[model samples]
Target: MAARLRRRLALVALVRVFKPGTPGVGRRLAAVPRLIAATLRGQYDGAARLATMAVAAIYLVSPFDFIGVAIFLIVGVLGDAALVTWLAGALMDETERFLEWERGSGRRPVA
Candidate 1:
């Protein structure tokens, strides 16, 4: 099970690293608004997950950070990339969880 989880993480990381031409990019982008709507309606099972996503979004937009711009520039642009990657992964994971919840609750949209 642990190995399976590790492999899943690696896969997600690789997908995020090579974004912009991936198969699920469009679907994932579409899901973001739906996720937010579901979240607003209190449809998801976990408030903690929603709050964490909110915090991540805020952090991404805020100019302040633990690492200054000068420091990031010195580090060859790793800090921003790492933060964006983490945010993307978190959003994708949260959206997927919400989708599962929708299906489980019999609220999934009919295609």
Candidate 2:
């Protein structure tokens, strides 16, 4: 559904990622390497989801062009725009989780 897709985009989350706080964009970006290391070492539990988001990000800048723009500029760009929004929001959330995992604080796993 279009409404669900729009919610997935979460442009506001992209903006909020940069807001000053414990999980700001600067801190999030800083943790990426550690996150990857932890995942590869089997210390983190969200590897699959992280890989999916990484692929989405790589595809966004990928020259192969998932949605060719030559004939459908608007549609093609919109597709990338939507992917960007989704990736940004997902990154914010994933990084927040990683940060909590790092400090051993914040939300606990649902029981």
Number of the predicted model whose TM-score against the real structure is largest: 2
On a 0 to 100 scale, what is the lDDT of residue 69 in model 1?
A: 57
RMSD to the true structure for each prediction, in A, is 5.8, 7.8
Candidate 1 — worst ten consecutive residues by lDDT sum? Answer: 1-10
Report how far off residue 41 is in candidate 2 (Å): 0.6
lDDT (Cα, tens digit) per residue for candidate 1, span 11-93:
38446535664436556566677777776777644466668757867866676654465566745357667767766776666
Best lDDT among the predictions, by candidate number = 2
Tell me the lDDT of model 1 at 87. 67
Q: Give the TM-score of candidate 2.
A: 0.72
lDDT at position 36, candidate 2: 80
How close is every model to the real structure, measured as TM-score?
0.62, 0.72
